[model samples]
Target: MSHARRLQRELQKMHQDVPVPGITMVNTENFTQWQMDIEVLDQNPIYHGKTFRLNFKFTENYPIEAPEVMFVRAIDREIPMHPHIYSNGVICLDLLSSGNGWSPVQSVESVCMSIQSMLTGNTKNERPRGDEQFVLGAGRSPRHIRFVYDDPTV
Candidate 1:
């Protein structure tokens, strides 16, 4: 099957697996990108009672090359504050990372779900532990950053 087709199938599986309320790509013309909404379900320190948009852009070399994911909106403030996420809502998940372990078998839906899982277990409203500077500098573009989670104490 083509890469697009495989991605679609993977998305379908993700929609089925995700328990949170969100939409999946069901359009015909644009299978490369997906749009959805995610919110702070659990009552945590911050990000409570807030909703954020989720955007996933699959490339022709998806799985092998991580999809371009981001959060875009007028008043969006629910960006994932992970060690790898940028300020513009672009995530720095492992699968999306370059030499870390990117493969061609991943799917758009799975990627989204992975993000959801990452957000599901959090209680902080701040960016990754100590990436305030990078977040301010990194724009929405695909920033090339090899995450160094050296702070095992975190």
Candidate 2:
């Protein structure tokens, strides 16, 4: 299916289903770029009541290619401290990589669920090692970095 058609269907589906507590669509001004809000449902101190904003950039290849996703620094949306998430909002999950884990079968909802699960299971309140350096050295897009899937369980 065309990327535009598929995205429209996904948007419709997202509206039809009650969004998972903390995850809500933010912007749809243009199909190529979209934003969403994510909040960890658990009482994990690390996330507590913090709501995170995620930015997703889609290309024409779309599902065939993973969308570039990262957290956005907003008024109430702070980047979560996780071993896999950089201070610059770059996420290192394999699920978002086109290399091995990404699949056309996955949708925006599924990606949100996976990230929610990742945060719910995390116990650390630290950023990835060298977060300061990495954040300073990285490019604008997270897709340019080849992140190592160092850990399986968060």
For each candidate in turn, give its C-alpha RMSD to the true structure in angstroms.
3.7, 1.3
Q: What is the lDDT of residue 19 in candidate 1?
A: 53
Maximum-TM-score candidate: 2
Clashing pairs in 1: 63-103
Off by over 4 Å in 1: 11-29, 74-84, 129-132, 152-154
Residues 37-71, model 2: lDDT tens digits: 88899889999978888899999999889998898
lDDT (0 to 1) per candidate: 0.61, 0.87
Q: Tell me how far the alpha carbon of residue 101 in candidate 2 is from the true structure, in angstroms, after superposition.
A: 1.2
**Model 2 regions more than 4 Å off:** none
Tell me how candidate 2 scores on lDDT: 0.87
Error of 1 at 126 (Å): 0.9
- TM-score of every model versus the real structure: 0.69, 0.94
